[model samples]
Target: MSESKSYTGGCACGAVTYRIDGDPMAVRQCWCRHCQKLSTGGPTHNAFFMADAIAVDGTLASNAHAADSGNELSWYFCASCGTQLFGASSARPQMRAVRLGSLDQAHELQPTAAIWVQEAPGWVRIDPAMEQHPAQPPAPPPQNQS
Candidate 1:
């Protein structure tokens, strides 16, 4: 069998770092207003993985708020440089969304879906090949537990 792939990355200032074993369960671009605000008017690209797959080091700061779906969402960042790191939702505590920009540059992952398209700005042009969702789509199937 092939060896499981591992990905590594850290915050802009290198104060926080993380490693993820295996591949991501899903990659998506979110255009929700909250995401836009976080991304400075652009979509937030994320790679969702089984929460257990991620191992982080160093202190992290976080902010939690209720989402439109009623799920409590929390964003984690490097306390020093303020670089966003990961996001988690109460609706799927077993999953964690790693900000794409936080992943190592060598990683090849890319968003396969665009969600909350209804909230995308008129000037934004989503890739025609990507699966589009006017709003939140169904959660990704559960990852292997073993």
Candidate 2:
């Protein structure tokens, strides 16, 4: 098993902060239209974690939208700096999709897959090693209950 590590980070303006304990569930790059719109450069790098593993502080604003995966997605961000934070999906209430860029060690969480490749622009190149999906990939089975 991969060694568990803790992470801490915040918004650009320093108004919001968060901490994540232990390893995340999954990490991936999202190229969906919504993600593209939300991204500053290109694909949105996302790291998924159980809600209980995250601890956040400060004010945030959120917008709920229907995700391509047929889940209701609530995107949360720092209200002051407009920095995207994490996305909460109703379909997976226990899961929180955090914006990898907001992590202090964002580079450590590399994506293993790319989703919504069909919506990516022609200029975008999908990584050869990462699994690619045209749309929403099949979700893994829910975590085993202890």
> Candidate 1 — which residues are off by over 4 angstroms?
none
Candidate 2 Cα errors over 4 Å, as ranges: 1-3, 144-146
Cα lDDT for residue 73, model 1? 94
Residue-level lDDT tens digits of model 1 in 10-112: 8999989999997888999999999998888999999999889999999999999998789999999999998888999999999999999998768789999
Highest TM-score against the true fold, candidate: 1
Residue 51, model 1: Cα distance from true site in angstroms: 1.1
lDDT of 2: 0.86
The lDDT for every candidate, in the order shown, is 0.92, 0.86
For candidate 2, write residues 1-146 as lDDT tens digits. 56678999789999999998877778999998888888865988888888888999999999999865687988999999899999888888888888898997645788999988999999988888999999887764455455
